[model samples]
Target: MQFCDDCGSLMHADGDEMVCSSCGARVPKDRERAAQFVSTEKQTFDDVIESSEEAADEGLPSTEATCEECGHDRAWYTIKQTASADEPPTRFFKCQECGHRWRGYN
Candidate 1:
């Protein structure tokens, strides 16, 4: 990555010259092999949680499954990729009342 010689901002490859979008400075023939190591490796979880306003507007699918904690008759359910690709997806359920979470392997 090349930096702007005028404003010291990051420069990108634009054909033969490195062009700075900040101050419009062009550094010619200084195409150094710079690896822009942006951290895209982020850990993501499959926890299906929704806000109350979104749930009220979109309306999550409710099941007749009872909550073990508060004995709520309805729950919001979603299928999640919890295991290997050869295996089946797990079903995650959350209680609407008590917000209890549980999963079932299919």
Candidate 2:
């Protein structure tokens, strides 16, 4: 067990230095030392969490529209909403494989 130099509390190995959990004190820094021992080591972590809203905003596929004629996947699609009695909804699609053109209004 190591003792803190500042508060004389028990210190445990936290990371790079012995830290006192109760008093929240670590090893004192020596400004006189310009360079010290250096080592290249890999750090490991057990768990990580990320926000899902960031993924959705990055142009990830949140929703997909399937073509009813040939069942083709598309990166971009047009959205059509329901129309009132005086107006009618219109959607147009052109297929490259079968050279088919279809449209619906109503």
Candidate 3:
């Protein structure tokens, strides 16, 4: 990106020129200027989003977990990392009927 010499604000890449928004000055696009502002290829990364649907997917064992809010008799549970590596993982429960979520330490 280029900056306006007059107003010191960032300039945008307009068609064939770099136009300053604050000062309305136009800098002609050149090979050296384009090379200085070339965009690098974006690095691919894995998505870090964890969803409730993905967590409650089929194959998890169902135990009789009572919902504290709605009194539902069923829920899906999974162990999640909540502490340091030396400690035991915590159990998370989601109610089947009312979708109430709770956690148990043991």
* Top TM-score prediction, candidate number: 1
C-alpha lDDT of all candidate models, in order: 0.74, 0.50, 0.80
- Global local distance difference test of model 1: 0.74
Badly placed stretches (over 4 Å) of model 3 are 1-59
Cα lDDT of model 2 by residue, 24-87, tens digit = 9887433343135332344444454444643322333222334557765442323365566567
Residue 89, model 2: Cα distance from true site in angstroms: 97
How many clashing pairs per prediction, in order? 0, 0, 0
Give the local distance difference test score of model 3. Answer: 0.80
| Model 1, position 89: C-alpha lDDT score | 95
Q: List the residue pairs that clash in candidate 3.
A: none
Candidate 3 on 1-106: residue-level lDDT in tens? 7788889898877779888999899988777769777643454445634455755444576789899999989888999889998999999888888778889997
RMSD of 3: 8.5
Tens-digit lDDT string for candidate 1 (6-87): 8989876666777898988887753244344232335455565665653652366778889999998888888878878999
User: Ranking under TM-score, best-scoring first?
Assistant: 1, 3, 2
| Ranking of all predicted structures according to lDDT, beginning with the best and ending with the worst | 3, 1, 2
TM-scores for all candidates: the values are: 0.46, 0.25, 0.44
Superposing all C-alpha atoms, what RMSD in Å does each candidate have to the true structure?
11.4, 16.0, 8.5
